[model samples]
Target: MSDASLHNVTHENEAQFGDYFALLKPRVMTLVVFTAFVGLLAAPVSVHPFVGFTAILFIALGGGASGALNMWYDADIDAVMRRTKKRPIPAGKVTADEAKAFGIALSGISVVMLGLATNWYAAGLLAFTIFFYVVIYTMWLKRWTPQNIVIGGAAGAFPPMIGWLAATGSMSIEAVLMFTLIFMWTPPHFWALALFMRNDYDDAEVPMLTVTHGRRATRNHILGYTVLLAVLAIATGFTSIGGIFYLTVAIVLNAQFLWGAIKIWRRDEDASEVDNFVVERKFFKLSLLYLFAHFGAILLEAGLTRYGIEVL
Candidate 1:
């Protein structure tokens, strides 16, 4: 659909509460919440259970607000993209104006509540995160540059830092390491998806690496980023938050991730299509586990330290 046609789209059915919830992009919100939670727990300072719960709640609200705003602004391209076509706005279940108001209201509520419940430092980070994702990434970089995910990934990486701040009311190297892990992991994770779904990006006119540079270059970039990601992930294991459990998880996961990236790098489009892009698909799935496992292991390390059973 043309952007004009998309703007004119109207719903024949009434918007349900589920439709509004879907606008939050709950699947993506899961990762944001998990990483943020891990960050909060891993901090040196202990937080009151209620205070911790409140902080995470407001942070998740901020993440949901960002999602709504992103859907509102990108509804035009989202309407054409197969992967995104069923979203609340693109599916005509919700109007862009509704999403915009919803997002703005949620953003304000989240920021203010977080500041009242936790510290302003964490609240400030949450506010910037919403702005970066909605304005910097979704609005400008996504359409204008192929390096969109590269620079825009910063928005996703901030949650952990915010979580750390909520607990400690300050930043630390441990928090920065947590942020770095996600920052470095984002490119290879999304690029692998782009390789398989290149057509969606092409049709939508989004300047993804696969759309702008072709699968070969995309594969190369994936391999390159995976190498760097491996370094960062493993190095994080030696930081204050790291323990034997996290180190073991990092080494094993990085090896698997690098191997998958190599498989993707070696395959051509013809071979990929003939095999249904299995390498890329597996790489993408592994990328998801790679991140979750790393954070889970970090949380485990923190739990052990509390019991005076630190694994060094």
Candidate 2:
């Protein structure tokens, strides 16, 4: 390969600070940080403020590290997908090698610092989360199978577990329930996006469910998962993490989510195209709120329980 193609730093397309930050995928990191923070706060035991802060900071770094490594490996498909073509690497603002090095260094620092600040359990989970995202999800599953999001979702689900472990120094049923909630939510959330952006995956040859199974099958899958997710979300209400507040939130959010899924399931492909996938887009947006509200309510109940108020 030519030197120019070797991701040389001195190249004319020099990287800016923002470009490097973009490589960390700050948007996704926001969700990771928030959910993890909630998980830490919702644990049965209390954490010192400084220790909690350090743990969350390191967790965010681990999440960012995962994002950087994902970009490094997925730069090719990212370059071809219109939605991702503007990412740092494909846009020529950052080099793949730079991202890889940054990710590895951040991964090591984050995991070691978290272990020192919190415990080995949280650190071990964080390390595995990073590795799963970079290796299992990005490198292996994404390009190889239509079930990529279903299996790769585990990487995203681990943050709350890590956070819970960070606070209490051990795992609990509550933490596992939190992890399960995110795990189940991931499929329908992503598949909704895929329904509208199916062409992008097709053009990039990424083997997303929508590309392999067709929109009808994808729609049916969304409804099926949404049904299962509703059961899981409501069942969580009985867990230690759930309170009356969270149960109410879960019921309302799941109802709206199920309604959206039903609408998508009922829509014909011809009608969806004519309507510009309006229902799918709405469902996609709602899925974002669905996860946040559920986690936020959990945090709220945790706060209430701290003050001696009885929650569910």
Candidate 3:
């Protein structure tokens, strides 16, 4: 159905609370919360438990606000894409204007509350993150270029840095490493999904790598980025955040990730269609575990270090 028609569809029931919450993209928010939590805890400085909780809460709210704003702007494309056709705005559960208002309100509340709970620097980062995602990524880049994910990925990478800043009120090598990890990881992850989802971007008119560059080039890009990502991930283990635990996780996961990328690079579309993009699908799923395990290892290292348990 056309976006206009989708928006005009009569609804039998009003949007429930869950519909509004769905505007926040809870799955994406989970990543924001986890990485931010890791960043906060991994910092050298300690924070009061209540303050830390509130800081994370406000950061999550800021992330949710960004998601809402993204949905507001992308509703048209969302309506066209099978993956997103069921989202609140596209599904006629919420109006674009309403999503925009909710986003703006949450943005203000989260930023101000974060400033009150922690420091203005952390709040400023959070504010910039929301603006970057909503304005820079969603508005300017998403439909404009194939390189969108590469550049726009920076917005997602800022959460851990914000968390680190919330704790220490300054940046560090560790924080930058965390940011870089996510930034480098985003393209290949989304590209793999694009490969499997196949025609979604084409239908939606989004200039994803798979749409513009073709699957062969997209696979090449994934392999190239995976190499770079593996280097960065392993190199991070040598930094202050690196310990025996993190190093082990990094080495093992990167090997699996790199091998997956290689398999993706070697396969043709015929093979992919034969197995229903099994390699691509597995790589996509592994990408999720790959990130969480890396961050989880860092968190564990921090915990062990706090008790003077040497992780070297």
Index of the highest-TM-score prediction:
3
TM-score of each: 0.95, 0.95, 0.96
lDDT of 1 by residue, 61-108 (tens): 899999999999999998998999999887878999999999999999
Query: Which ranges of candidate 2 are over 4 A from the true structure?
Result: 1-12
Better of 1 and 2 by lDDT: 2
TM-score of 1: 0.95
Worst lDDT run of 10 residues, candidate 1, spans 5-14
lDDT of 2 at 99: 94
Residue lDDT tens for model 3, 109-150 = 999999999999999999999999999999999999999999
Q: Give candidate 1's error at residue 87 in angstroms.
A: 0.8
| Candidate 2 structure quality by residue, lDDT tens digits, 200-304 | 999999999999988889999999999999999999998888878999999999999999999999998899999899999999999999999999999999999
lDDT of each: 0.91, 0.93, 0.95
Best by lDDT: 3
Q: List the pairs of residues colliding in candidate 3.
A: none
